[model samples]
Target: MSKSNTNTRTQTRASLFTPFIAIILPVIIASAVLYRLDPLEPVHFPLDKINRSAITVPLLNKNMRLGSEKAAEGQVLGPEDLVYDAALGVVYTGCEDGWIKRITVNESVVEDWVNTGGRPLGLAFDGNGDLIVADAYKVTGFHIYV
Candidate 1:
């Protein structure tokens, strides 16, 4: 091809690529600057707790023997937290099936205590034998729709 035709082709190629670069260059530069400022920055969210570092080493097991055993038997799914009640001689565990179950020491019997109607997370007991549960996705036996 001639010199003028080659120049026109080059300009045509540059024009075709210019709009893409115009749209993409700003995003690339902004992302680079944000990453440079804080590479581990979390996105803007309401309940997102960004931890600085993770504790990987096991704190309780320096030279420990790993042991496992079955604790209970029932439809008790997702026991997130367990609290022992010395008065009843039973261990109460909050489950994801919305039931706080009581199990014996020898994994013999499991009983459904109360159905919270939400997935129970944390469990605690007061001095008056009152059990406290941190139920997720529900408030006061009603599911919160957001």
Candidate 2:
């Protein structure tokens, strides 16, 4: 309506845009600088002589694929590693939430084996059906009594 009032409105609009530009411009400049400084390169590691083992699990039915079929027949929460005990015919998997799960492969059943109080990473079975687990926070051994 008035000249001074129009000027004040323009200044108010500029003040709102100024802070948005100030925040966005620095982020764009920093992203450009970082992109130029550290250009990503394609990494190719040749596995010429790496010794590897292949594990084959018999499917419950002929139509089920190996990886596509669920091992535990339920949702696995952050399973990091798995080990199969041939003697006991059971498979153990380490979980992130301080849990070790036991899955009977033949029966397609899963159950919580033990809680380690820390994130379990690696699992193995020692002699006499004892479960050995490696936790994330510490590298100590855990034996679970079946």
Candidate 3:
């Protein structure tokens, strides 16, 4: 609380960041130089030749909506951003219905995963396969940890 103690605390916090900068600064500088030095030719595809296949999922052409009605059984509504779990073959999405829905891509099954009690706007899966949601009107972003 006093001036000397506050100064020491500030210095301690500044020193804590020093080691991180020291370790990362050289790597960053070296990466910038190496990135500029690397030999790589620019690629330019013809305007007419580029198709959805050029930069999309392998099965992006599949009509996922045709059978979604039967799969969802009228559960999913206003689905927002989704995260696909390749290992689980499922996609988690936030919905305007105030629930997070899990759709089993392989089986075409829809299940209400969680009730956020508010309009869920975005969805993501953490490293441990847990779902994260962004509830609307919360004044927050996708970084909501829990």
Candidate 4:
């Protein structure tokens, strides 16, 4: 109510807020600097540098859904190790559901191709044009399915 009392209250509020700002500003700046120095597993691989002369793998994002979209579509559980069949113009991915899914990159068409009876953990095509599937089961853990 009195002028001296109001001024004292304003000074006290300003003193409290100034210290908070001084403390928080350095913390904010230090956090930014540290993050710029070493952040999480940042995607350092540029899209252009991927799959050219040296052959960049998976950086080719055409109709590719990164991982989540295909996994959601057609029950492609735990899709792993995408092996591109360049000759066939399709990508094959092993899933945890004991199946290999063939995906047409341009069309985004997913087909349930082969079931390994065990979890298809990895997929690759051999020189003989046969798909070599590493099916991992609970007991044995490894089996080659061709």
Top TM-score: which candidate number?
Answer: 2
Please, what is the TM-score per model?
0.47, 0.48, 0.44, 0.44
Per-residue lDDT tens digits for candidate 3, residues 38-90, read: 99999888877755455557757667677554455466788888788888888
Q: Write the per-residue lDDT of candidate 4 for residues 1-146, one digit (tens) a residue.
A: 99999999999999999999999999999999998999578667886776666655796778665554433365567787788888788888888777778888778878888777877776667677777767677454333343
Q: Kindly indicate the candidate among 1 and 3 with the higher TM-score.
A: 1
Evaluate all candidate structures by whole-model CA lDDT and list the values in order.
Answer: 0.76, 0.82, 0.78, 0.76
The segments of candidate 3 whose C-alpha lies over 4 angstroms from its true place after superposition are 1-74, 139-146
Sorted on TM-score, best first, the list reads 2, 1, 3, 4
Model 1, TM vs. native: 0.47
**Best candidate according to lDDT:** 2
lDDT of 2 by residue, 24-142 (tens): 99999999999999968997777765656778888677775656656764456889998888867878898888878878888867888788889998877777777778788876778
Clashing pairs in 2: none
lDDT of 1 at 104: 78
The C-alpha stretches of model 4 lying farther than 4 A from their native spots are: 1-75, 138-146
In candidate 4, what residue range of length 10 has the lowest lDDT sum?
Answer: 137-146
